[model samples]
Target: MSVRSSAGRVRCPVCARPQAQCLCSLIPRLWPPTQLLVIQHPDEASHALNTARLLVPGLVNAHLLITESLQEHPAWMRRLQDPRWRNELLFPGEQAQVLLPAAVDLRPRRLVLLDGTWRKARKLVYLNPVLQSMAQVCLPAGLVSRYRLRKVPQAGALSTIEAGAEALSVLHPGFDKHALLAPFEALIEGQIRAMGLARYQQNYGAASDPAVE
Candidate 1:
């Protein structure tokens, strides 16, 4: 079997990518009206491809919580239950509404995003009743994901950082969402270059577009 990566590469303390390809410069420090709570699944917490790890440090007030359940974290549970801020979950479902700038209230808000695969995100939502109780929102239609490194089975699916950027921009319309995506795009391009043209073409670009995000 082929190994995807070396076990002991020196990784950047912030973005967690290899030190040579550290994405710290590309990451911006931005503050939005809403506080971000990125709930990452424990299984992928240490994965090199994990975007949630990169995202939390970029934003000034963002926090990353790696857990399968919320009941264990009393502080986070209280924040989620905080009556002052509106709690919103960035996930799509039959009942999910499109996340729009006009739709979001100006009041302080708590945006909860699940960082994991579709299945794992579903499982997180199922396991946490507080996540289920929050208002669920989806990204606008026709948004193409720039995360070419990952194959998303679902169309219009975005990586966690991508979703966070878009959602934050919509929540606070003044900031450009693309600033947040610079490091993410840089990471993808670096990985693609490392994979080489032949391998990337064979694995990612065999189709007219890509398979998906």
Candidate 2:
């Protein structure tokens, strides 16, 4: 077996996206009221299609951390204990409350998102007791995911970028959710273009697929 090296591929030094699909220019410099913290599984860090990387550049206060276990990182644990930032986990579990305006506490905070496949994300939460103790929340119902490049496990499941954008929208009502999604949509469109319409539709489903758009 052989592995391909990205060194040969022309990529943007900053966003790390391939030159053709680089979103650095499209990313906004606005800082949202709330901080975005994406805890990505090590496996997802180098995935060509991962959307978590697209998030940081769009929001000034956002950050992405790659680690398999939160318990292994003392800094993250300290951040969780920090009084200045209210830490909340964005996950869809039985204990997770709806992230609606009335249901959530919109205080100065760091919204933690697990960036990985469904199974991997669950493993992360299960392994970290600190994450279990934190308040967990889910996006409001009736919202569809626009991450068309990959197949989602469920209908309402959103990509990391989409989830972060929605969290920002809920936390900061003044922010424009559409603007946040613009670059995300571009990333999907770029993939679709690279794969060609037919192949993209075959792998990700048709444009009419409810999960798409």
Candidate 3:
């Protein structure tokens, strides 16, 4: 058989299924009313196998924002006009905390997700004056990051999907966050395995593996 025949019709590197015949629907759904917006660094968008993409299927009101600068993006201006919503940037700082939307009286229930490397994330905050004024929510957990493709400055830094699920669970309890998170974790793990990064499959590539390094 030719290589094309061997690989099947546009096979996915991870699930070994065709792009249109994906088993993603076999996974559960976590449809929260809370609006989710993911802002990705341009570089991350190019290089990432990005677990964040899985989120769009599960979320009812989610959007992906990509730009070199948050301040210059036209979407930033449009989102601001949404009077029914209030936003919070998920970051780690002295002020970061878990805040309920009701506690802040933020309407339309908004969450602005940042999907990028640690350096890019720092830049997102440093360059965007609008993000500075928003509330900052930090995750409080003993969990380390689940991303194995890139190195992070801190263990607390999590992948885009993991961070979003954690934040939503905090904002709304019993929100079936696992439905969204499990599939994402599987997808990430599958990608690492397909790339022959067995260390990533085992323990997020933390287990002293030269191949992943």
Candidate 4:
């Protein structure tokens, strides 16, 4: 087995590929007109299977803040106070009732996505009191997470891309969830194959050889 990745290929620890040719694109991009902010755990950012970076570049208005703790960050606090955007955190709490964007009229359009492990996410919410007060929206999907690399504590907690697109779709019911997700998944799948991950190839790609059928 090839333990080391070649040039132009990345070593995805989950799928196990090198950086130059990473298949992270298989995760979808949420392209809503609303302002988007993703605060990811800094440790999570270095993980090979992470998909947060893929989201930031695709959006017209998006910001990705990778930090271990955001509670004392002046910049993070300042951004939260930006009156131009009506901010909401993408976290579901027992105390937080389910919010449908259509039911309420929020003037400025914005959403904050927390991307990380369940433990890290919980820490993020607990440490940031400001985020706790933000309107919370829980995803209503019965679908399992498409992220096969990491084990989630709950089946419902989806990948970063999935969560982002789902949140946007709820905000705008007519949004295309599939379009946002397909390209990114394709990219991830492609990169995984390039790194010699056979499982992703069989599960997500066209075929090793179309004629084999």
**Among these predicted structures, which one has the highest TM-score?**
1
Against the hidden reference, what TM-scores do the models get? 0.90, 0.87, 0.74, 0.73
- CA-only RMSD, every prediction: 4.5, 4.0, 5.9, 6.3
After superposing candidate 4, which stretches have Cα over 4 Å from the reference?
1-31, 82-84, 191-213
Q: In model 3, what is the error at residue 202, expressed in angstroms?
A: 10
| TM-score of candidate 3 versus the correct structure, residues matched by position | 0.74
> lDDT of each model, Cα atoms only?
0.82, 0.79, 0.68, 0.68
**lDDT computed for candidate 3:** 0.68
* TM-score of candidate 1 against the unseen true structure: 0.90
Better of 2 and 3 by lDDT: 2
Residue runs of model 2 more than 4 Å from their true location after superposition: 1-7, 102-107, 207-213
Instruction: Please list the residue runs of candidate 3 whose C-alpha ends up more than 4 Å from where it truly belongs after superposition.
Output: 1-23, 26-29, 81-83, 104-106, 148-152, 195-213
Q: Per-residue lDDT of 1-213 in model 4, one digit per residue for the tens? A: 324544545364332435455444554345576778899887687666566666666565778887766765888787786776677777878765554775465567778888888888888888887787787777775857666545567768788877877777777789877776664566545545555656555565635633122
Off by over 4 Å in 1: 1-6, 102-106, 206-213
Pairs that collide in candidate 1 are: none
Q: Taking the tens digit of each residue's C-alpha lDDT, what string does model 3 give over 114-199?
A: 77777888788788777777788888767676556667677677788788888788878888777877666665555665666554
* Model 3 lDDT-worst window of ten: 1-10
